[model samples]
Target: ALQHYHKPSIFNSDQGAQFTANAFTGTLKQAEVKISMDGRGRCYDNIFIERLWRSIKYELIYLKAFDDGNHLSQEVSTWFRWYNRQRPHQSLNNRTPDEIYYESCL
Candidate 1:
């Protein structure tokens, strides 16, 4: 799909064992994509994802007790919509994630 869309690169998750496996590394190598890993025990290495988790937990998860998977999924979707479209982020100069993402394209 990425190739079909003419996408150049992809960066991702290296914490999981699947990402560390020879098969996975070989696939990326075959595609000539750069492989970057977070430094061991360095929380700041993945600050963006960490911050996202903090925001979700504090702003949504902590505010409610979900009764089931369906309820939790609905709440999570709503939270993500607000977070991406409305919530201001300091790292983005107070712009929302969607705003920053689109701004970068220009």
Candidate 2:
């Protein structure tokens, strides 16, 4: 994910082989991003993102049938744009994620 987007201050993921692979970790280290791994038996460490995934699957993926990868990618990107810029999150006090993020920068 970081390979294509803005560098994050910290990257958190489960201790899956892909995440722990040298190539991935080396890229993060070179970028000076902190690495965080979810501990064993602590499932809720990534609950928020997991919840977002659930929302995406149920609300978008499950509801659409794409003809190709490009189609799926475009639709997913559109969904994410709406999710960040329009959809209000209850946990964020009914504000969109984009709103909260830009507000924090100020």
Candidate 3:
């Protein structure tokens, strides 16, 4: 992710073992990224991501039958591209996420 996209100022995640692991946190620290972990039992802290997952599941996953992990990953990647670059969100005033994100970057 650091190679393909600009490094984020902050990385947020649940208190999962994979995220808390030294190797993972160390990499983020090396990149000068701040880490934010949600409080235990505080699912609302990540509501936006949770909504995204719900959208992915309803719009893509539930509709498709994947042959394997590779296929699933590929399709999901395509869906994400569409989601970010093409799909407009009412919450974002009908602008695609890419539009809002790049606009904010400027």
Candidate 4:
């Protein structure tokens, strides 16, 4: 599955079971990706992901109530699109993340 998809040259995460598992490691290994793990008790090393979850909970999840898994799946997908392409971020100089990323690629 990973072989068919685009893979990053580096994958960084905490030392969680899923990341530490042989199955996951094997996939990264085969794809020649370097795995970087944060040190023990060092969540602040990745403050961006932390801020993202906080923003998602505060802006979207806390405000929405879903009746079913299907509804939730749909809404989360919608939320991701809005977050990436529509919502302006002060940190990105009021530009959307998609805009900044695409321009950087060009």
* TM-score per model over all chains: 0.71, 0.88, 0.93, 0.85
Candidate 2, 1-106: lDDT as tens digits: 7678778999999888999999999999999999999996676998987899999999899999999999999999999999999999999999999998898889
* Count: clashes, candidate 3: 0
Residue 70, candidate 1: alpha-carbon lDDT: 100
CA lDDT, every prediction? Answer: 0.82, 0.92, 0.95, 0.87
Q: Model 3 compared with the native: what TM-score?
A: 0.93
Give lDDT tens digits, candidate 3, residues 7-102.
999999988899999999999999999999999878899999889999999999999999999999999999999999999999999999999999
What TM-score does candidate 1 get on C-alpha atoms?
0.71
Ranking by TM-score: 3, 2, 4, 1
Better of 3 and 4 by TM-score: 3
Q: Work out how many backbone clashes candidate 1 has.
A: 0
Score residue 46 of candidate 4 by CA lDDT.
78
lDDT of 1: 0.82
lDDT by residue for model 1 (8-106), tens: 476566366887899878878888877887876677888888878997899889999999999999999998998899988887789998998788789
* Backbone clash count for every predicted candidate, in the order shown: 0, 0, 0, 0
Looking at model 4, which ten-residue stretch has the lowest summed lDDT? 1-10
The regions of model 2 sitting more than 4 angstroms off are 1-6, 40-42
By summed lDDT, the worst window of 10 consecutive residues in model 2 runs over: 40-49
Q: Stretches of candidate 4 above 4 Å error? A: 1-5
